[model samples]
Target: MRKKGFTLIELIISMAIIAILAAILVPNISSYIKKANNEKAKDIAAIVFSNSMRSYMKDGKFQREDVLNNINEDLNIKDNEVDVASLYDSEITVDFKVSKLEYEVKIDGEQSRYDFKQK
Candidate 1:
């Protein structure tokens, strides 16, 4: 009589297929994860820039330290959750123009940059 369960050769073939599929997928998954992190960093930069502009409008001046503190408070984010400051390489810059305010932030490792102008 034929065996009711998978034979040794059948099991080996199945395991080999699984391993091949995993090898193909693992690198793709890691690249996707890296892209997601970059996007997240960009989003964080936007938030920081917006907050800086808002603080400037409210107080008539840009205060980096104050804006960061307010961001932590308003977002209810603790240091352990995510260090928002660490996402960027340097501080946000605000330039005053005749009719608009320009803000720029550089992402960590110089991977990306965010610029916004408000009139």
Candidate 2:
């Protein structure tokens, strides 16, 4: 007479198969998340650049940290900061720099995604 349940060998084999599948899938999922974060960071960088340009035109100065909330109001963005933990592991910051005749917008921790000078 035999029991109806799976044998120990069968269960172990099934568990090993699941483990292998997880090993393969986990990294892929992580990579996908990182790619998504990079894409989001790029898009946000563009928005920040344009926002800075607009603010500079209207206010004669670059957007500063203190006025980020006001910019958020003008832009209707959810918040002054962004969180992309998959790539940056912290909230992304929108920083600005101004020279005599130009302003720069930088997304902290994500300089590679920034390209404000492009047409």
Candidate 3:
């Protein structure tokens, strides 16, 4: 009588297929997760910057360090910067650039940039 269970060749083939599928999917899933995290980080950073800027305006002064500090405090980030340069951290480095009302943020090594203007 023929065996009811999978043969060695069939098992090997199934495993090979699974491995191929994982190889194809793992990288795409990883990239999507990284992109999602970066998006969330950027959104939080933007909100922090906006609120800090409003506070600075209301108080009739502008101090990048103070604003950054306050924003960090509010956001529970230990180290943050508001310079028109790179802000490095353990997992990512965020670069900030502002010219007049235009502002840009480059997160990590991604080419995608977030830009905004202050009114």
Candidate 4:
């Protein structure tokens, strides 16, 4: 009678193929996941910076470092100084500064300033 199931050699070949595919795909998948996480970090940083800056303006503490506590804890941001004068004025052209490698965010404007450094 002919065999109905795969032979041992056939099974081994199939497993080998699966392993090869996994080897190639796993790194790519990991890299994509890392990139996604980094993007999420950036978004969180932006929100934190903007909120802190707004709070500073509203509280009349534009030059004070006391604005850091306004951000939520989940963002994992640390205290850092934001130089509003250097960042704003008529010379200022951008609202934010982001560094993916350093995981830093800076918000620049006339009313307030904020610095976020990831930990």
Candidate of highest lDDT: 1
lDDT tens digits, residue span 50-108, model 2:
55455445654444542365457565555423321112322134543222112234433
lDDT of each: 0.53, 0.49, 0.51, 0.53
Per-model TM against the reference: 0.60, 0.60, 0.55, 0.59
Question: Is candidate 3 or 4 superior in TM-score?
Answer: 4
Report the alpha-carbon TM-score of model 2 versus the true structure.
Answer: 0.60
Which model is ahead, 1 or 4, in terms of TM-score? 1
Task: Kindly list the per-residue Cα lDDT of model 4 for residues 1-119, writing each as its tens digit.
Answer: 88698999999999999999999999999898878877776676666566555655674433333434445333445444222232432112112233434455555545344455554
Estimate the overall C-alpha local distance difference test score of candidate 4: 0.53
Q: What shift in Å separates residue 27 of candidate 3 from its native position after superposition?
A: 2.8
The 10-residue segment of model 4 with minimum total lDDT is 88-97
lDDT of 3 by residue, 1-118 (tens): 8758888999999999999999999999989886665666556657655545554455444344555666666666545234433343211223332222223443332322335433
Model 3 Cα shift for residue 8 (angstroms): 2.6
Error of 2 at 24 (Å): 0.6
User: Which residue ranges in model 2 land beyond 4 Å of their true spot?
Assistant: 63-67, 74-93, 96-104, 107-119
Off by over 4 Å in 1: 80-119
Per-residue alpha-carbon lDDT of candidate 1 for residues 9-69, written as tens digits (9 for 90 to 100): 9999999999999999999998988666556555555776666556556655545566667
Candidate 4: where is the Cα deviation over 4 Å? 62-70, 73-119
Q: What's the TM for model 4?
A: 0.59
TM-score: which is higher, 2 or 4?
Answer: 2
